[model samples]
Target: MTGASAFPRWILPVMSAIAAGVMLALPYNYAGLYPLTWLAFVPLLVAAHGRSAAAHYWLGLLTGLAMYLVATPWMVEFLQRLKDYSLAPALAGAMVFWFLTAQLPAFLMLCWHLCQRFCGHYCLWFFPVLLMVFYGWFPVLFPLQLGESQSAFLPAIQAASLTGVYGVDLMIGISNALVTAGALQAMGWLPGARHTSGVMGGAGVLVLAAWLGYGWWALDHWDRQVSQWPTLSAGLVQSNETPSAAVPAPEPGYSRSWPPEMALSSQLARAGAEVIIWPETRYKGYFEVDQVPGAFQRAVAGLGVPLIFHDAEQQGNGGEFREYNSSLFLGPDGALAGRYRKHRLVAFGETLPLSREFPWLVNWASDYLGDFFANLTPGNDRVTFPVGGVHLVPAICYESAFPGHVARSVGAAPGSPLLVVLSNNGWFGDSRQPWQHASATVLRAVENRVSLVHVMNNGPSTVVSPSGRVLASTPFQERIGLVTDVPYTPAGQVFRSWFTQWPEWFAVVLGLAGLMALLLIRLTRRQA
Candidate 1:
């Protein structure tokens, strides 16, 4: 190939990686720049055009790493905390952090390769479909995806009800492909005329416009169709104290007691809140039939309202001793009503993946590092607590990130259950982690069409409506409380079925069918 005709292979990939990385990092860094999310993958797609599979794969991995580094800088804070321990462990933690970030990119590139082989030129159409299918099933660090960038845009987010987050992701992927194709042609990377590319580019713009228009229509239609339902008066307590097993214990008589903390809840209840919420694992003791903290029990009795709190439990015997991160419901009678263990554990943060086989590593980590994540066991059952006339589904920290986890927790209750998300984000401090974490709850509220009461240990606790609207919220790092009448939509919304049931599987089957049809077509053409 002539110099003019030859692809600037390295340069294109680098450009794609940088552009995609910056675009993704922009939304996370500054919420106002969320519009950048639409354009994030465009450069990457442009670079992928007429490139080798290996090149595309490498470019994708680099973009993912860069994006995570920029977006999740708080991850480094964990390493910084460990820095005083020693340099080697800190470096090891950093390596693990970067590797975790690279996971989705690696999987995405593999999907891209498969699509390319199956669909040929039409693979771009399946890009986002594959993404939705794989990502929904894949265990990701954060459930924050393309759909979340539009969290502020309620109309756009409303589509998440029909297709979950994947719907928005699909639109984004198609838009990027269209833009990439047009750009490639305009830049002479493709054989198509610039005019053809322009039309394609214009079509992509129209698609985006139409999407927004549909969102507007959906929002209007939803508003018209649903009758106003009852609102519950709920109170959320946001304490300044963040609970962590890794932190050093306060000196003797430094007692950070619950009496002072219960003051906020007591005031909220007297102000007419029907329920009160406490942050995750705020009560550090192991809650069991035999042993429950006296102070916590008394606080529950004093409140005279259903109080919700989470704790870390130590269960089993001897070598089988397993830890659980659980949320407990204490009735007005100060008795344990029900409990829900956190279903999805944070991979390395809550539970070590292969610790059963590597007991030595678990022992060492526990002995030296205070068992930060080596023992927490995953929960198997969904426990819903009844308050007044409604059931409350409990979602602990990290569990709120998973749409499926939230969906299952809600279940098919007699009435629309309110999702209560209890979290202690103090570990992250005044970082973007809290903001990013809040974004997921918004998506959950929309997807489940249920009002959510998010009670955080640090801050940013919010009461969200079915339409992804924040009814009330407290700012981050504040020691404050919130009282609001959280609105609930009627049961049997379309989203609960789609998200909880089969849309992802449908996408997968559709892609597989397309792949098979393409293979058959190729065979026929070869024969002819």
Candidate 2:
């Protein structure tokens, strides 16, 4: 602790927070810096060494705040656009979200400090295990796991196929923890065996090498396997229109006025697209299942191709009426083929947490925030749509972030279904939000060994191969149609990834092992 006081007491923590924040944020903003994430936590870890639990907690919170602010400056704009909040209120709301997210890191630091106190230098081995458990189970508004930062690194990320993102997270955490231990030992802050830094550094290098080797082999194997699967030409349309909830739906029996997306769909259909996909909730109206809208029916018929798009749907009588964010499929004949309601709804944006139980909170919050808050009801079924001899599993917006949910959806459907993620990123406009959102698709594709097509209202719309390769992508805020040949398992051929079979297995094992180790440590100390 004395050696750590070379500078002012606050200087190391502040500097370490800045360094870790920038390193972590850079990968999300610029994909090429993904490798920086391998050591991103080192600065914070090193600075936290020999610190009190309270100090570690504050350092972790500061680092988390810096990371969020640097990575998602667009959040303030999102709040402003989403609720029409003024500058002050929007900034305040953004800070609230930052503070809430900071708790995860704060808890991690506190737990790490306690482990160090009990286990001494052996805490290095437990650090990654603790992180794996936290990242696996800790709930966050947005699940930005450390593994996703390595989404751009296909070789390293291939580990996700076996352990579902937790494996890659564990790998990165181990490297950071080991490096931090080495740095502390070299600085004399940690009294350990001689050449401890060299031993730790060598261990880190070996772990990284094994991780990359496994990734390379898995990528090659999956790539070959996907190549032999049946292929279909699919078209993704990014209309780039920011649809407003305030915009009223056209009256029933209104003229068949086609949106710009219809023209794009027509062009894609003419170019031999078998199925055309659209972003989430682009059609701004209630789509009654029985009473099909003439305009929508005609538009789909005009294309002469299967169409998949998002729309709001209402069901039940007055008192029991509920609305849903849904994905609907239209057959080539322009008839309702299949519909899947969104299962996951965004908090505050789509639904208030306890509004249903309290009911009055909705109205009070709406009046306070100057925004209407009609919560969208969540769907219970994992519905899949059949398209051109292949089934399509749909995930709307935030649902794509959950690996287990997406995997279960794919597993629920017979045969190997293609994952079609429909998202609307217009609220966050021209920022790292879209890119970060899109990065999840890469891991989803790899984790389930399924081809995924992520179509967004604003851009970075992408198509990813089962091997985690970006087959095609569109720039941000562009009105473009990307036509790509998507590969999927042929009908009657079911496929399941190892990770899908046993999701979060790595995290579970690590948690159990950590518990057993702690028990053994306590028993050994008592005996001593």
Best by TM-score: 2
Poorly placed runs, candidate 2 (over 4 Å): 1-7, 193-206, 243-245, 248-257, 286-292, 368-372
Q: C-alpha displacement of 484 in model 1, angstroms?
A: 1.2
What tens-digit string does per-residue lDDT give for candidate 1 at 127-156? Answer: 656666555555666555766666777877
Looking at model 1, which ten-residue stretch has the lowest summed lDDT? Answer: 250-259
Minimal lDDT window, size 10, model 2: 247-256
| Model 2 C-alpha lDDT per residue in residues 291-352, reported as the tens digit of each score | 44666687788888989988878889888989888898888888888899888788776688
Candidate 1 Cα outliers beyond 4 Å, as residue runs = 1-12, 82-92, 110-114, 117-119, 192-211, 223-227, 243-260, 286-292, 364-369, 490-497, 501-503, 510-514, 517-528
Which is the leading candidate under lDDT?
2
